[model samples]
Target chain A: MKRILLTLAVAGVLSSCGNNDTSKQAADQTETAHNATEHEEHGDHDGHGDHVASSVSGNTSVNGPVRKSDQASAILDGYLAMKDALASDNSAKAAASGEMMVKAFASFDRASLDPKQQASYDDTVDDAREHAEHIGTNSGKIDHQREHFDVLSKDMTDLIAVVGSDRTLYQDYCPMYNNKKGANWLSTSKEIKNPYMGSKMSTCGSMKTEIVPQ
Target chain B: MRWLKIAAVATVVVLVGIQWIPTPLNRGDTRADKDFIALYAPPARTGTLLKTACYDCHSNHTDYPWYSRFQPVAMFLGNHIEEGKKDLNLSEFGDYSPRRQRSKLKAMSSQIEDGAMPLTSYRLIHWNANLSKADEKAVLGWLKSEIK
Candidate 1:
């Protein structure tokens, strides 16, 4: 009887620990999802400066010199939204975010930048807009969207290089992507949550370059 | 002895038969005179190094080696050329968007720095294409100044 009671108690403790572990994992996933969705429904607004600024408002711009340009920052915001959506494997949201990117790029003012920056802006933004439209057009087709994202991420990195960014971003690369043809993208974090291979190879890429604002 | 004779005959026949198989060459009307090399107009020596190291696989015009006439090697070179061009084609460099050009340059820089490119198999065969340390520094340094 004593042994039976002891064994039952140990089993109860193990089960409770298992439940806690699962709950904690669920909570982490939810938090990550929430962070991604924070930019959701945000694409509808044209007030990109105010929107993008809010997310990256605090420490960097307060003390450090270089600030994100209004037009560039808005584009970055749209990219981040699409990237986060794809990272979470949300094709529907990825499409929506891609649409926002098209709108953001279309509405961006090029005349405001210097001649060199403007030239780069014109080319990179145009290329990125094409990829964004593809992603936007293919609402349920995540694989196709991912193919475009492969190049789009490279586009975004080049854009940020020319236009600069408020956020300290990392240029990440996944060697396993596109039959080892290799693909690259800009990420706001150093963590290896690959947008290219969602879930299957989520932690695939490594940070290759650090992009700190001017 | 009979089995060995049969195997030898089969190998010869297969090799001879495959010679008739047509392979696609990288040669195309899409070749650009205003290529990456042409655009930058690097020093003649630098240009030579680039041509030796890159253009064989990364250009629209791939000068076939003697072995490229062989069936399987021709096919292998064809595939490598296609993949290399897909990544960064000098002939199509002018056609790529500014972002793409920069990205390709960056890719080249990384590949060179990390020693991931010139693909060991390629370097083993095309010894002239091997990029020495000084060659790497000069080419990458020029690219860094240009890409930005």
Candidate 2:
């Protein structure tokens, strides 16, 4: 009887350890899901203003004028141009757009922005300029340019979060890029023309969220 | 007494039987030129620290322990390796874009400084993987310089 009881107890303890690991994994999954939902909600809130502006102006074009200053629009225009070029696998055009972005970022009017917005803009532009320079100078190295573009996309996302954009932008994610670490890029259309993979795996990504002009 | 003896034999049988259900190892034979070690070539000490502390999960090759050949434990480690590679693959570091390389370096520095890496569960088993203050400083210093 004693041996039987001990065997049952040992088995129970071992099984409980397996249960703990499963529960922990479940909790992690729930947390990730929660964070994704929160991100989507935040994007929707920022896009609300742009939705109102487009409706009021009766602008049927998705690229309607935004409430932001002209300087911000110029930066967004340059960024979108770069995004399109990268998608088309045109390194020379991407480099030109990158140079345009660098210029736009340099001349951006921060005086009109609030103190907090100024801080964010400064942080975003500083890194952005470096990435843009790398992209602009390495037109022959499309792979290198795409690598910088991946990071530049992130900087653009940060910029858009603060200043908003003149058009609705879809945030697309490619699971195959960056050694399967994945990468995100912004697009005007819902279709996934993966900027990271270009023509090689052009339709590899899926739209994660949409950023409406604020 | 007879029932207890039978149970013991059955348990041993189960343990030995499960060993044959091979868990796939993360070991990669080919050393890629794009490996993090090959790309930046950190000082010997810094390289050792990174290999010992981070590479098991963050790289394509894992120096698995002998006990890992056992059932359940091997699967557990295999899962961890898969998850870790999904976040960052140091073996494929050379393939990352310049911007990504910079950002990953920055992230490594921050994670080291914050002591969020070499995860608690991992450290519990692999004591040598624990980074002392000096190890942390050396790795962080190398990472800081590399990012620039």
Candidate 3:
């Protein structure tokens, strides 16, 4: 009877130890899961914080020193809206948006340009603006205008690629001032030049400029 | 299954036969009158990188892939090359005046920075053309230095 009692006591202790080990393992697993969740939450928080920091106010001017994100945003919005209008087959709206777009780009000061670039810049803008207006206003071939817009979009896309690489232009032209940096209209003298143009065209030697309001 | 087999055979036959079709390798009649050579004479390392990655299509001398001899694919490649070269030919880079060169350079940098050029689709097939963060920094660094 004594031995049986001893054996029963030992079995009870063993079963209790086994249950404790399982409980400890379960606790460790829960801790591990909690840690993983915490890490994920922390990562998400960091991402959100970055997004918040990079966010821009629409009306802000990107006039000198640091390029304002909002200026890029505004131009991008205008261009995209113009594209959207064209895509939707809204000729009047496209023309209007296109005019605004051209005007936005045209506001750059001519003095900033190297003489040849300046002259060419003016010519190209005039031609592009004229063609855009004609296409926008005249009902001759809306399809042709749309095609032209598509080509322009392509040219713009290609042009942007080159501009993105040319940070020098961004540094010199993207800002509102030069040496005499002070308050001025938010604009980018950042220009686009067509490298493929031969000498026959006057603007072929020039770059197109884009100017924006503060 | 029989129809599918016949269609597959027909497609293969047509594809093989197209290799014999002569395609015009038209090159632009680039003029020597412009300062084309002078401008591109001293290409920076960044310019070299751009040439390697983008100029295949954007320049006159497109390093055609061996497989470009095949039809449909060859035609598509030809069209891209022609259009790209038409848009911007680095071979004729020196022809533009300083202002034009500067603008073109700016446009080149802008396109790269914006993640637009060397289209992702093109890069998918040509893995070597893919730009890494380091490559981008190097290329943009050189381009940004040009404004002065």
Candidate 4:
């Protein structure tokens, strides 16, 4: 009887230890989530000299990447299809294609870009539509439409580069960086270029708000 | 038993009554546009989109939601808006000077492409602010031109 009781006590102690471990895990996960959420909520606007600016809030639990995963992706696909269709300079097809891209660009998720960068994105979307519509309706050359394509392509390229490189600016600070990969950081190997001047070392982090007023 | 019933009623009353209490509105400070203009000047379409969708939180002047007048929720909104604008303020764009503006635009484009801006939680309620494909192209296109 004594041996049996001792075995039961040991088992009970082991089970309690397991429970404790489980609770610790749960707490850690919750704390990490809480901290991340807090960072996003507060970090969106940390040090501007003006009035209090609110961070653009988002639910990080959504399905897919912070960029390519939403409804905006489908719109991009359709726009690309139209671009391809219009390549033949088929007026009718081009018009239809142009419309698709226009609608797609107009409706692209504005909420995706941060406030500081949102204005430029908006302008690009509008300009691309204007060019596409003009090229589609008129007897413009395919080269002309391709010019607009170049414009759109360039914007997309820049946007991609910024998105890829900007992980460090907000990863430790903004909640928007709460994607599955955690905050994206810069690898030391890459030469940080300045946004204003290509090939300059003025990376995005260089523009951080100044601590002292000029 | 009577005291117990009274206590239950009081608790319910407090819970129900708290919802009725009005919270302060966030009538953000908009006088800081000088800095905003200096730091960033988006091309036409992209600038418009930012003004419409992001200026509320990221700038000095937040539009404020209806429920923002309620406590707790209002507090949450206040903290968020303050934080957002601090990280990047549209109203204070001019403050950054030319070099800073260029860099800011680069950051702006990247954040948009990466789907880190308008914030999903924000879009859930403000449906009009949602960017369709065309909108994305316009904004991104403009940024590309300016950057190039």
Which candidate gets the maximum TM-score versus the true structure?
1
- When sorted by lDDT, best at the front, the candidate numbers are 2, 1, 4, 3
How accurate locally is residue A186 in candidate 2, as Cα lDDT from 0 to 100? 74
* TM-score per candidate for chain A alone: 0.67, 0.67, 0.35, 0.37
lDDT of 1 by residue, A107-181 (tens): 777777889878867887777887787689878878768877876886776576566677877666555565544
DockQ of 4: 0.02
Model 4 bad stretches (over 4 Å): A1-214, B1-25, B28-44
Structural similarity to truth (TM-score) of each candidate:
0.49, 0.46, 0.44, 0.37
Residue A183 lDDT in model 2? 62
In model 2, which residue pairs have backbone atoms overlapping below 3 Å?
none
For A1-214, candidate 3 gives per-residue lDDT tens digits of 0000011111221222124477744543444334334434444221111111122212222222222223224334445555545445556676676666666565535464457645644544443444355445544344444434533443333222222211222111101111111001111232212111112211111111222211
Where does model 2 exceed 4 Å of error?
A1-70, B1-44, B47-148
Query: What's the TM-score of candidate 3 when only chain A is evaluated?
Result: 0.35
B104 in model 2: Cα distance from truth in Å? 7.4
In candidate 1, stretches whose alpha carbon ends up further than 4 angstroms from where it belongs are A1-214, B30-33
Q: Rank the candidates by TM-score, best first.
A: 1, 2, 3, 4
Interface RMSD of the candidates, in order = 8.0, 9.9, 12.8, 10.3
lDDT tens readout by residue for model 4, B54-80: 887888677777776665677677777
lDDT, candidate 4, A50-167, per-residue tens: 0111211233211112232333443345444544444334445545666666676667677867785576555444444554564455444443443344334433322322222222
Given the true complex, what DockQ would model 3 score?
A: 0.04
List the DockQ of the predictions in order.
Answer: 0.15, 0.02, 0.04, 0.02
